[model samples]
Target: MKQINIFSIIAAFIGLPVLFSSCEDVLDKKPLDLIAEDDVWMDASLAQANIYGMYENLNYFSHWNGDPITYRSGGEGYYGWDYYNSYNSDCQADLYWGHWLSGRGKDDTGWTPSTDFGWDAFSLIRKTNIAINHLTSEESRNSIGVSVANDMLGQVYLLKAAFYFMQARKYGGWVIVDEVLDDIGAVAGSDESAAQKLKLPRATLQETYDYTIDLCEKAANLLNTDAPSGQINKGSAYALLSEIALHGAAYLSYYDGINVDAYYQKVIKSVEELDALKKYSLVSGAEEYKNMFSDYAYAQTCPENILVSQMNESYGYRDAPYSHINRLLVNFGTALLNNNINQSFQSLDKGYSMTNAGAQIQPDPQMVEKAYYVIDLDRKARRFEESQLFAENIDIVMEEDRWVPGAMREKRKLKPTSSYTSISDLMYSRRDQRLAGTFVYDGSEFLGNTIYFRTGGNIHRDSYVDKAREMGSMTGILYSKRVPQYREIVGNLNCTNPIFRLGRCYLNVAEAYLSLSTPNEAKAKEYINKTRVQHGGLPALTTETGGELKMIYLDERVAELNMENDRYLTLLRTALSWGVTDPTTGYPTGEKGGIIPELNRGNNPTKKLEIEVPGDYMVEEDFMKPNAYFYREIQVPQSDHNFIFTPKKRYLLPVPQSELIENENLWQNKNWE
Candidate 1:
């Protein structure tokens, strides 16, 4: 028998330790002991044990860490195989292997398929299919009570839908396996010709997508409405449905398909149905919103999270440790910083005391550019003049208050050694809350500790030199979101990962409305405003055209969902809807514009400052220049960031080479060769 089915069957029958426990509520805990395979489907609780295995394959998003320079060997062994952070397609992270964009990798050879994206999801599918098959059978249902059987089937169906959706989005066309193969004997036997005959070929992309939708619909009907946190329910199915509908609608609209509007209607209906459940609502207020990402306990209670994967310490699946998350983004202890001009000396000892503190990956310059969209520039300039320096010239103005540390930073006067102005106060204390919550800028206070992301100098005494290849910088900017809260229980990094929230649903509706033949300005704005007004205190959208509004919607997604691993997908989908030509290369992929440039590292222009204090006394500048302190900051290049999309080929990942040989009838994606 194939290992995929064999393992799943063994797990299903033996009963793994996966149990039904909520992020807060403790349900009846299953024992760690294994049950006999024959007796597994005999009872409701035992059958439920197999269902828990389905979620084990779920991806947690932001674990995409690796050797930024080498590109080989990194990440939490399982999650983020997409190389999301460093692939540098849409994310702020640096890229390691740039050639993959050109449709070449170890598996792209004509003889075999590629394993670049690790697209071996067949095992997970087979496992999911087997569980579903058994749970829906007459004998299993009779043994497991009617209600329990329905609920178990629903959960399995939901898992199946998600797996198929993932396959469809990545591979476009995929082999559909809705049932467990009892002919595993033939498949594993010496009759190679017979096995080849039985091997399923790829289905059309449309069929794959429709089948996923049907699976989700069935799951929604069968799932329990009152399932606890971490368990899939009716609401989760709707959330999945809405996402699937929006994706389908956008893709269909891109190709001018006839049923695009119908799919859009489904998107709206599904989201509204989810909302009608009343099981979740967006968390209000700035502090409350921050808690959704920072504090695990608060996250568990947040009403907005519809499909959340739970992490726990005692027994449940714990996510990557908090320290790992910190190290990947902040480089907390290693302090890899840009050696800016006239920079002050930094001592590694001064930063976090942890051993892994300095392997920091600073945000790409493009990220800072996106952050600007959240604020109203005109309003800030007119009403909050002090914020202008920080808002526009963040690289030059956001300096560390060297003399004032910790909580004292909020009250201290700008020291002579610091470039610290009133900008931090204007930005954090009064501006949009999302800015403070999402990023760690200069003059920001995190857990009462002062965060210093200064440019124009070497801030770390013992800096990691290799970070230069990774494009490390001292632009007084760092990336921080969903990090452990300062007051949270220590070692509780098992935060609930949000799969669907009301805020995203609103975005979906807004986009779908805008995509219609006659865009609904008011309806679209209404949905967009719900997120803006509730989360950021930003004004509601009222007078923007459809194109302008689309930009705003994209900006909001970057602000809110960047770290959650949606950037590349968002860019891809948007590009598909309206094709673009590469400005630099003049390479047009399709009739419509859909091209995206791969931007590169750039440096900000030098700024001359007049300080009352002597050059020797300035901590912002350690080395004194002959005439004036010429502070040069690192910036994201306005043009090609070292990459360009090759339209169709880049959008869909190539099928794995092994999969091709295993199923000779399968066709490789177009242009992959």
Candidate 2:
């Protein structure tokens, strides 16, 4: 999205902050001061300027503060958009790290619904409502071209629906404010009725769903199917509808005591509609797949991206800072791009960007287990043979440490470097291409240097060791999806975050079919095969039922959508389907114990250090024997770090205390008080 000078015109009249602009390629100018309400509708460009502001104001990563890789413990921050923040890949450590100790409050004591994303939405909703009112006014058709007006109006509805969908999912049912609250003075003045009108209570869950779906329907009717990546088109609208419809069906099936095959059918149809557009498809090949996340340019045009949050550029007029996901994956003093020399003398440039590594958010051991299971990587060596795991396979290790297979030609052609051999190279060589592509494995030739992250390696250790202890032991698996190889010189970290992907649609369709009474296993298998069998090269899932199939479907999500902000919602919705009922006394009044508890169960493993006697000091026979040294002591659980989440209390966040205080009619959600 790009900023324009049109804010001078709009802000002068409306007093809104001028922090937004257009997301398109062109900008048109019209005289600002002369544009009255009557004249504004006559000029299409002016109406569009306001609409453009709406696009700019839509909550993208750049718009929100706080690290995307870590949740801010002081609740949702000022913007109150904690849904994705709490659910993003960064927050997975909370189960062990205790990041979310408080439930939407400064401390564990106070939390209210108003401070949540549900209430944060009113800011954007009001802006969009104003755009909708203006664009749909009787004079709008006369002022702008009918087709163009409808296109702009379609965007407004789409955005409005998105806000409503977010609110409905997070805050259950809240009051719907569709009309424009334009006249601030009139609404805030000493009139009791006007103030009373704004104090409406929550709406029904069904009503919120219906309203959101209706807006999407209107958007699908008005917008073009082949819209730009940044813009909301029919395909995007349908994709969102498919997701919303699935949620509605899931909610109704378990919570509302309603059977919703109709919703499941709707999900299938919506996904089909998106597919019919033929605009986007998954990027194929392992290198290309990894690049789809790291390379901004490649991802912008990648068919897999249905919707995205685009950062303009870096070091330019509109250059936005890149997301520092790389820093979150690697440890400090750990050379990136494979420069693993222990001692750093002067003039030694590693040619890679080194990070602070303090904020590194390693994958949960459970998540690593799931990933390994998804790709079927053999961990036999890791399971039972500890010595064989890390030892260099001198006999099988390729000459000059040519770790990667099928690279013998390159090995023969080029002279050997100072790189050493290790068992990690052999292990990585046997894994699925996607696993190698998505994570930083123990040994891989990154750029030119061999990357290593094992214990006692050349890389510096910080909390990596502690986190490993927390997870029982480190698996040497770290996130690498968005960690670019050339980040230091790549100009911008502004790779458009993939907000929607057709691959996900395929998975969703499969789940929807499987969720039916007479499970459409064949149909589910067909859809699942499109990505898993064809792209991933994994064997087709044949016969599975009940919990087994659900687990498979969920594992697929973990493999495909980790760190993309889908996990939290996946866990929440799945828990609902598990028939979670309102507890008699707990805070999770109407929620279920889902995959989160399962993932967080059990204590992590601990590792012991071994020492060998020096050859000179030991007898010849004694030299061969191993002696147990000392193991690292377990950390005493700190009050904050020792947090144990009560499912009922922690699942749904509370409204802001301010909201409760201001609105006498608005009470807190269930046990939050």
Against the hidden reference, what TM-scores do the models get? 0.73, 0.72
Residue 2 C-alpha lDDT in model 1: 5
RMSD from true fold, candidate 1: 9.4
User: Tens digits of per-residue lDDT for model 1 on 271-303?
Assistant: 888878777777766677676666667766677
The TM-score that candidate 2 achieves is 0.72
- Candidate lDDT scores, in order, read 0.52, 0.51
Badly placed stretches (over 4 Å) of model 2 are: 1-42, 56-120, 182-192, 312-322, 326-350, 355-358, 374-422, 460-475, 487-492, 579-595, 598-643, 657-661, 664-668, 671-673
Q: Deviation in angstroms for 1 in model 2?
A: 15
